[model samples]
Target: MKIATKKIAACAILALATGLFYQESARAAIPIQQWKASNGAQVYLVESHAIPMVDVQIDFDAGGRRDPADKAGLASVTAAQASSGVAARGAEPGLDENALGEAWADLGASFGGSAGSDRMSFGLRSLSEPGLLAKAAQLAARQLGEPAFPEAMWLRDRERMAASIRQANTRPSTLAGRAYAAAVYGSHPYGFEVTEATLARISVNDMKALHRSLVEPCRAKISIVGDVTRAQAQTLVNTLLSRLRLTVPARCAPLPPVAEVAPLAAADLRNIPFESAQAHVLMGQPGYKRTDPDFFALTVGNYILGGGGFVSRLSSEVREKRGLSYSVYSYFSPGLHAGAFTVGLQTRPDQARQAVEVVRQVIQTFVAGGPTDAELQAAKDNLIGGFALRIDSNRKLLDNVANIAWNKLPLDYLDSWTQQVEKVTVADIKAAFRAKLQPEKMVTVILGATP
Candidate 1:
């Protein structure tokens, strides 16, 4: 959404938060209306007439982190099955995932989303036509509250997923990822990835057990964006929510302790020997959580360091200048807990060790010195300049809203995004990086010949 005009006092204040200096008749709105449903589900609604479509996303704290140590993929499986309607045993006759999808298609709508480290997210996108919202809402309510976990679909999905994991085990990149997660997270739930063995042990009943504990109203966040008015959105939410059997706990269950919380104070390295066409290198240590104040700094700084692609320091040093590899990049993954700041690349086996060393050197120097003023300004410019595109589409806005609600970020977060990036000074980036990153105690994973 373009910055709106400041003539209206409220719009003006919101515009100012965007750090936009131009004089406009109106400013974009972030009037997020929030309320808790009878079942204790948190709902956030943003009305936008920019499109005639409505987007709905509901997230539960039912991601991998909620998966038991022995049943690492249950949360994901449950969410997936719920969305597809395949595991929703009590659904209407002939309403498998495919049939549900066909019904939605008839109504000019789509249904999908993903499970992640901290959330099992699902979405519904449809024209704001007369009956679409009610129908979509009904389906979502049943799937969320009363899934049956159909055995046939579960067996099929489990077998398919197990085979995929088995195949991924043969890929160097996949092995490196598994190794990296294990090395960095230690015993943290984030470290757990489903293995063939783990998948085999997860029965259909196990999924239902995990599903019962994690998919509760006490742990749900709902975000709606599009052409609907706030009143209309509320009606839709309230009706759909009435079906849930919420039992709010006295206190949210605490996450298990992370075996390692400190960013590496010394290098933790692992090398897996495998015959590959090219060496895969991965490096980084613990990074920030989604709510970390320094998140903006880390995000902007990472652009100049490696997140900015060819213009970034890592690319400039490792690929453009030295011609070591065609590509290299880095990112700070903000999750339910502290995430990893991973840097990755691939190069010829002969140059694998040197490439890893060069990457480390680049990180060491950048962490020590930070980005140049020019680099910092450019990153901010690019990031701020491209901010509008982040929510240009209905789906995109829905995604951002879901993230904000799921993370409990301020509703004005998107409105102030540009200003936050603009206010990030070189000092902020440097200081934040130095404090958050530890090059000395990083984990490095390389899949190739180790000499």
Candidate 2:
């Protein structure tokens, strides 16, 4: 049986790797279907019969932002431990972590859970053959609703995580990140760090309680991509969420609102001394939320500013013209709330100040005048040309669908993405950047830099 399972798994993997399952061209228009599930879950599907496999992502409102400040990392550890084991249900026997792994392997499918800053997600991938998909969905539902949160397993994983945190603390990058987050986010939950003490505070009961309260069917947004019809996808979603034990009220209760990431009040600078030869510098401020109207403008503008790699103005100014650093980049991490807009680079400790000054000047100039006509044209052309790569595979399409579902974006968002990028004019970029970024109030963190 084991040998047979190994062969099946290998064949499934090979099929996926060789793109044998996908038949559609990358540039085809994606027709998205959206509906409300019987259990109040929002379901989004893109029926692609070209592939005989399915990719799914289920997202909930439970994530790091939901964690209590006193017990940071609760959502993360809860998500991790959900797959540790599943409790027995009547006639079915309980499965430990190892048993769970074996079961998924035998079916040539995979399911796992993770939590990011704004949402907790469970993802599953499997061949859509009737028997295989049924077994995979059932197993996933069981794991989702019946996690044991074994005390022994939690204790073991906690120790391992604590040790990893200790090792990370010794690195300059970690230290810089921690300081930068604290400086930028202030009292926001987004800045909460997972310390050894915080890990020690997380008990199995906490995981169970959090999972019980937040992982409700009503709060789920299910995104599916692959070779399944609407009826089949509906059934698959129902089965995948069947194990959730909580009864849904006629109307789901509103969760307590998390405070937004606050805008910086003043420029804050931290110069930490370390023994490293290269200095790490990070500077930024709260940008904007995913739902902001200026998203496309900000995105296109960021590309010209620093997100376009060596072609970006920041790179041209900081790396090529002055030769202060080999690389320098900036990005906007917009989420449910205003995420950070950061510029980062590494340079010789002695040259750190010069690099920092150059990056600052470049940003100030760009924010004031916006990109030139030529730069704006180039950014739009590059972004539009490369859009196909975003949805080239099942996994990537699933991610994009999930983003749409979570952010409440339009159903035609993916299809109209290039149009949005193309329509972003120099005036739009300038107005958006001027409204969102405040260079004078940005937070700066420099580690291993000389005074």
Candidate 3:
């Protein structure tokens, strides 16, 4: 499945709101147990014996947003080579990282991670065997601290990234997302792309430097769910992550301030000739930051606008009323900084313009009058009342915790999520939305618009 630019945009944006809703059916307060590992890593453990599997993640602050201008792909390449067997380089260091990653994967476990705009993550899902868990975690920690970004592996990964870059040009949604990010995050690392030139410039040393400077115990938050106690989780994190001498003081960078983007007046149309019957359109601008006081209000407001699926105004105007599209939705993505507040739809190519107009009308109307109290109440009830299904599994809980860890949100953030949603009065939602999103200034990217 070749995911498009908008899909990637949606994926990246949705990850930020992973813990937006609270699952009240947790019955008992599923405490977010906190501890400091001896190695300086903060650990959050949720002991859930509900399942026979354990999900653990070691997240670091070394995401792509911190990549230096000279070496745009350093953080990304460092993240990619995290467990990809950095052993092709000559000697013991190479062998160590490769073996470490392999060993972690060998014990009936699956491993994966990604570097986002503000954080990088390494996750493991394994059978709930403490001994096996110990080995896997230890291996993960080694991969974290001792990554030897070998010349050969770095070159190979760069080539792979470049190949994907070449392919993205022919993908409408990919191009749209890149354009949107470039337009919104201008001159910031948030807009950086892993292009052929950028990837080529990223040397093995750049990756090494990034891993050395940023992948520290201090920048780490390890979350363990299923079959683990607070003490055991702490020991696991310490034993695995402590040996690395990571004394780099925290260097905090302020988020890229919200940019004043102009409307897409003359559409920068592009063709990615495909046989699919419909084209996808993604519109809007950078949304809210995770720590923004109005995050909850914007979220609830967006739910009423288009995030409520069939119940949303976008769906009502663009799909049900006008029959211009199959689906239309809008959402607020609160990230480490301000994320994208996007409104998107996929429609038959012939009706694309009409669909876009319908969406605009809905947004403009909502912006002018805001949601009525009836609409506001419905969104809160659905979002809050339906929160339980979100925490149904250990993996889900880990996702919530990982997002919180990435944003350094309050430990009780999840517990207070429903309340936050409830506290969003009609006025709160309107003020937050009006302050965060400007319908007139929003950028719209319509991929594969029909002639």
Candidate 4:
């Protein structure tokens, strides 16, 4: 199974600038109205009169992790097909991609979807003009409730996807990422990227079957945000959510725990020699789940380590002090299961070993002794000061709300985020880093020119 991610290097660059300029003030605390629909789907709503718009998202536990062992990229295909068109059914007809786009555009609304590690998401955004919200909601409801997965488009999409995968083989950074995942997690679903063979096995029938189990109401959590009132929000949710399959699937089992492959006892460095001027290097190992107790500490510590780019320890050593590489960075990507804490850099082939040595030293030093008082203070101030931009827009707020509800995080998660970062002391940073990062057990993969 492949959990395909669309990577964004920087979460938000001009967030602070935009907030300060546009005055995206912190509105009232997000009063998320929580309840269940008559069909058993979880529902959350936050009413805001800040803007004349609305954002709605429906989430399902139908991500790459749930794909069959034989069909690796099935989850991604299923979600992708939903946005391109509405397939034809027995009595109901279908809408082509152009028709769908025109329909939304005519209403000044937009609809889209994505599949990830633990969930697939479909959302709608529209102006809160008279009748526009309901019309847009109905359009989203129809797409989710009745995806056709039409035959003509299937062949096109499959070929396009397969070609994309084949193209990734020639890129060293892509190769290193795929190899590193496989090495660290072993046979876990998180261990693999989508392969061409797996793509070949996926058919239109496979997607429809996956959709049956996925599009059921019981598997859904709906989030609504905007100028709508409680009555409007409830009605809107009911209209949108009631379109899902009413009965639960008979074999819906709870998800299993993240596979625990014991960290390596010695260095696990792999070199894939190819003709190249520079080497792509990646190192680190299994990290933490999204709801881990030490989340705050790890988050702040990572900023000081490599996540802050120019200001980070890795940048200071690898770029400032020695000029061994163009850039160096690290991050902890927490998902539904144990995600990786990865550090990556690109450097000349001859200096690859030196780059690796310096990164390891930084990790060992940070683990043996935590960040300084100045480093900790700076991290906290940056995180705390930048907190407003996270919730500055309705779209951003909608995303955070969806995360809290779907991940079973505290409703107060966003509200308490700054305070949590504020409480992460130096000891907390050291303990969390030592526990989570397996520096000695780190799996290092390098792609460079062969002698």
Candidate 4, 1-451: lDDT as tens digits? 0111101101222232253322333534556788877677788888867556778888998888787767888888898888778766677667887788777767667788888877898888776654767888888877777776877788888888889888988888888898889877667666657888888898989988888866777777888877788778778877776566676542235645545544556668899897787888999888888989999999999999999879999999999999988899999888877888899999999998889999999999999898999999998889888787787777788888899888888877776788899999999999999998868889999889344
Q: Pairing residues by index, what is the TM-score of model 1?
A: 0.88
Candidate 1 off by > 4 Å: 1-27, 83-94, 248-262
Model 4 residue 170 CA deviation (Å) reads 1.6
The lDDT ranking, best first, is 2, 4, 1, 3
Sort order, TM-score high to low: 2, 4, 1, 3
TM-score of 2: 0.97
The local distance difference test score of model 3 is: 0.70
Two-way lDDT contest, 2 vs 4, winner: 2
lDDT by residue (tens digit), candidate 1, 157-268: 8889988987988889899999999888887888898987777787778867766776666666889987798788877776655555557552346545434344555787
List, residue by residue over 1-451, the lDDT tens digit for candidate 3. Answer: 1234234334433432453333342544667887665556778888866444567888877777777766676776777776665333344455544565455435656566678777788777665557667766655565666665667766776777888889887776777677766665557676777678777777777777777766777767888877677777667777667546655453233344434323334433333444456777877777767888888888888888998899988888888888888788887766666677788888888887888778777888887778999998899999887777667566678888877766678888878889889988988877777787677767676666777
| Candidate number with greatest TM-score | 2
Poorest 10 consecutive residues of model 1 by lDDT? 1-10
User: How many Å off is the CA of 148 in candidate 2?
Assistant: 0.5
Q: Which candidate ranks first by lDDT, i.e. highest?
A: 2
Selected candidate, larger lDDT, 1 vs 3? 1
What lDDT does the true structure give each of the candidates?
A: 0.77, 0.90, 0.70, 0.80
